[model samples]
Target chain A: MTSADQVPFDDRGLAYGDGVFETVLLRDGVPLLWPYHRARLLRGCRVLGLEPPDDAALAATWQAPASGLEVLKIILTRGSGGRGYALPESPAPRLLSRRTPFAPAASRWQGVDVCLCTLRLARQPALAGIKHLNRLENVLARQEWQRADIAEGLLADSDGNLVEATAMNVFWLADGVFRTPPLDACGVAGTLRAALLEQGVVGEAPLSVETLLDSELIEQLFVGNSVQGVWPVNTLTTPDGEPLRRFSPTSASPLQAAAHRLLGYVPLSGPSLSGEKR
Target chain B: MTSADQVPFDDRGLAYGDGVFETVLLRDGVPLLWPYHRARLLRGCRVLGLEPPDDAALAATWQAPASGLEVLKIILTRGSGGRGYALPESPAPRLLSRRTPFAPAASRWQGVDVCLCTLRLARQPALAGIKHLNRLENVLARQEWQRADIAEGLLADSDGNLVEATAMNVFWLADGVFRTPPLDACGVAGTLRAALLEQGVVGEAPLSVETLLDSELIEQLFVGNSVQGVWPVNTLTTPDGEPLRRFSPTSASPLQAAAHRLLGYVPLSGPSLSGEKR
Candidate 1:
């Protein structure tokens, strides 16, 4: 979309990160897991005390013709709140949908090499568990890795609880069960993770770094968001002495197997990076 | 400035709150407190690891010839950092400026009423002190007060220490001395606060809520920022059972006296609202 169709400069998203956003993958111009994305964004608006966008308008914004695997991003912000942080008397949320060039298929399937980030996410229950625009924490964490070899970085809360990857959620297969960190305290509630939990593909609770490292029964590890699907972890390490390990769902755990099967696709190495155009 | 001269849709500031901004008031088309605003923005960019913008280019963007009083805002973002949080290698920073109608003289001095916000600021040393756009805390705090009677709200850090108002840095005369909350923990390093400190007009330290209520020495309260020079607080109250009181800074406190003389302004009042154009 051109700049004219976008939100105004005074939009609250730019002023205070007072908004929620969703990234949905468009397959043949149809957004995958859109309902889940919508549900999450709506819930986030409730938490932030702003009205969710009109469903029909949102759907119209999503209608498009996709040439390949296109990435559609929806940003819903509490529209112009005057000059300060205060929400206006009549809040009108701004919604914008935009697309980017497709991603490499390999980065989604073959888990990308990741390092533990030095930056820590602060616990802000007021803003926790929402895909809000206040993402300096993620931005700081992702800045940890500059090398092309590293595709992502894992993040932890201030208390050292393994929270998530910079842009994705983290899940581990331990004792044949899928486990990921709970979002009741901090971190965004990833749409994919919620879907997995509803389908009994993963269990939610705080995952400590020590617990993950000490688990000899660990079989498979993967990180993903709704739009990116899942990527198996081949090795994980950091310059700060975090241990590295390889894992796979196909040969290791039934939970991982179930997750892959439920996603309605055969597992592959890395994301479909540079794959044939769909 | 016209809308065309403003930031575009893809601008990272509107996308991720991925920028820092400074708002200065222009009197007679000459922006006041330019040095203070410029310095704070510079420090914020350094904290966020962004390249410094060319001062000449930035000064040129301040060319809007709005008459009388206006608000000149400078937005500095880390250029277009793409979809992910990782900063693009060797990327130039985006620096844009705009002038808008502002400073209804009546709103500046007669002093504005404020509420004690229910929302609390989260502590993050990595992102604290500097105004880097991750201001959901301020947004939430501002939302706590909607009554036209209350023009602003005061925010406290998660630890219950008085931080600042939703938009301005706070100062109080306690025990015949001017005291303000330290920004080293969790508050924006406001340009006005920096200017005041440079002039030795205020001292910074942790000002707990308990201390505010317990200190009988408090004479008057004021909040200041780059845009609003100084607005005195007439009343301060909290729903959480904190005893509230009003003091006369003009009569008792030397610091307040000096501030009044230096700022050379009275604050906004109910009557002033009608005479001034917003």
Candidate 2:
């Protein structure tokens, strides 16, 4: 928050939002799941025309860092390009490492109530899946809800295909199969989502909003990000505040317990809300 | 460009590309088409949920002391909000006024060569026309060509709709009618494009790439922005460098003359390349 941490006026990340970033959760001074994050950051660099980072330099930087339950972040920018959108011939990509307290709302750990955002994510294959700096869509989606009880916003594409929660990957259980929307056209392929999928804990399904509204087939809903691991969803509502579905935390849900065990974490839980119980 | 001119590291504009900007072409120390650019900037503010700028303060600031034939830019951002995408409860919007030298590549003023960009503009109706900071698509498209000869890159939507050049609005004299793409789904509605349209010098048309590629019907091509007023396109090529069409600059083209007269500028001409003689 100090003035010393400011970026230059011509910084491309500021002017054109030309950059990529990674949010790493630190536990005992070690960045959790760093390999996956590093890989994604590197891929973002190549795709955005920024020179890839040096692994040795990055490893030394990551290892040499200091204390507390802080959230560690790395931002890579194609430096300043003034007002233009074109990349400079010799771009000096700025590699910034910043540390901030990992103090997200405590309520986030105890499940969340999400509303379907009116603003749908644009299908951009070129920018999809990478943690790039252009995140106005998330901001717009999050802006839709202001109540403390509503923790996150769920987004879909223009075609009504389910995308993700504002900052987390979303999944639902339907007929005992964990169904998560494919993010090839849009949405971030979140690290936690990747880990769960790689561990054979979840499967991809093309779930549209209409399909998700069918409460009969769906069993459970959960959303997750690295910062919060995974949290069960308590309810889903339409934009006009109509409750489409309500989910209660249950130890009996095999996927819920399985996800926690596989990720070596506990699923976030809150008091059950009213809905047609399974 | 200096250390003093830098922005905060946590600037929502930098962290999330949560900002909007306007470029005003300055001639003889006065910004050309200020009203139009100012209108667009205010509209961007309303759309992005930032407080509207004080008109009196803005007018006073604009009338304050300044010099040079430079490009005047105004950047409005909802300050820094740390790592989150949510707007701060009490947002402090930063208004930046900067002047950069008006020295674009000389080749830009003359009839320029363009090629189809491999990247497609993702159709986000939420962000179609207004120039927000999330411009990775334009950066990626402009990166498609490194040749000094290629002045700009033409972009299309996922459905083969011709959007616009990477940095300018485009219009073509098709079948004796001035036709330009309707920017409903994507593309920045450049200030010059608006002026020309408002003046009845051009008409909106839903142009697809196939329509533009049909060279027989189109008589002339022009691309423009506030920084560089309208300039004709001399050649067009596919992304893979196969020649799609070659346009000739002719004094005989009435619409070309009309655009120049309407904009109060002369059409830039370079040594004619191999094309039909005028």
Candidate 3:
């Protein structure tokens, strides 16, 4: 509950990033998409050969005397054991959860400017899709801009393959089909994207920047994550700040309509800015 | 300083590994090779766009009541603000320094065994050679073995280019010359390795496992870091506990001898096992 009680200098999570974390939106003391976060956390544990902890207990401990709207962040680490990278004999998982209260963030990606980050994401299939803590690539990419005008920066894999934004998964509509980049290479498969795919609203495809920018068949672009749902993307800019291309929903995109119509709780149109508040 | 007064859950270092750390071996209340760690820490800050903290003040605080044979660990994070990957405006660097009492480790790789990890390191030139906190690769590689017989695990890049052991830079004595893997792609450039290079004891060369095993021109193999100087590698094995090759110093390795004799304080021939203690 307090800073001193949460972490220590010997924490393997801080020492070697031997951990995974999930940020779930809390609606009246309940974490939305609890199942997905729990699954991902367990998968991360399996990858690092750590035992899974009871996250339900952790959520309860975090939401005691909870408020209306807050973010419940659950971090499961290899605990304060292990000499270097090798897991300690009989390793127990360390669970650190917190609640940061905030107003519900509104969707405001329509007509926003995004730049292609000069920095590329390294291809690490071992760490791909499971949200582990070794996130220097995302950190460095997000640091590429501090302007109030830029909404986000698109990142590409080492082979110039379009991956995702720094903090969100990307989706684009083309030929009346909804396509998103496959997370087989390197990108966190966010819960919103998974939900969209499972509900027959979005499909997976290998996306390249060239194909997205050059194809006239592309109709609309959007990005989203579990915490912040879908928001339509409009503009793409080069690293030089030159306008690369502009896109909009040419027609009433069935996918967008289905996304909002099917997932009623997901906000699609609202006024908000990008930063800590969002 | 104790866990009661150390890192918080909201610290970016724990949340994102958005920080850098230095593990300097303390000799009787003195941090050895202080300059290299300082330079690397500052350089890491630059790469992450974090302002350099006054490490001198941190050192003073750490050594105020220092004792014999310990490791002084310093962590500099883009302190507790910011949401997601973006750096907070006018960020202040948070400094966390701790004295971990440790007995000086000695090199015992004369007839030791090391495994070649199946997990390959991804090439990230931007983060290559910097001791950033994003170390999932090393953690995964190290988890390949738990047996006391295994000394360390060798890691190669995705392209099969030999990079380093889990925590040390490797030096190979082949063709009657000293050569080390080019760390322009992946692997941490440790201070001891850098010092050996600066002292004209090691040179850069791209090595592959095939070359090291097949070519009879190869002779001695050694690995090192600041805390543990030069360790002579003996046998190599595959990840599934299969023998790849058995090797020893074909003759007296000049590199190893110089690492000990030339550098007065480097404990080269001492009998200290590698693991969390080292």
Clashes of each: 24, 0, 0
lDDT of all the models against the reference? Answer: 0.70, 0.75, 0.74
Q: First chain TM-score in every candidate? A: 0.86, 0.87, 0.87
Cα deviation in Å at residue A251, candidate 3? 8.9
Residue pairs in clash, model 2: none
Give me the candidate number with maximum TM-score: 3
DockQ of 2: 0.75
Query: Which sections of candidate 1 miss by over 4 Å?
Result: A1-4, A65-68, A101-104, A213-220, A239-264, A268-278, B1-4, B63-67, B89-92, B104-112, B217-219, B239-253, B260-278
Measured by lDDT, the strongest candidate is 2
For residues B1-278, write the lDDT of model 1, one tens digit per residue: 11233455566666678889888777767766678777777788787777777677667756656567778776677765565777776566667666777744344355555667777787788888777888887777766655666656788877889899888888887665677888776788887677678888788878777676567766677776766566677667653424366645242234434544444444323442533543
Query: Model 2: per-residue lDDT, tens digit, B1-278?
Result: 11125677777888888989888776656767778888888888877888767876455435655665577777778886633887886777777777766754434445677888989999988878998999899888887876767777899999999899999998888767887899989999988788778978789988778878885787788777777666678889865566888876743344445554544455434345223232
Better of 1 and 2 by lDDT: 2
lDDT of 2 by residue, A177-236 (tens): 887899888998887777778878888888988877775787778877877656667788
Could you give candidate 1's per-residue lDDT for residues A1-278 as a string of tens digits? 11234555577777677888888777677777677888888888888888877778788766766566677878888887565665677777777777776654443464456677778788788888889998887877766666666667888887889999888898887776788998766788887788789988789867776666666776767777766667677667773435575455333234434554544445443333323332
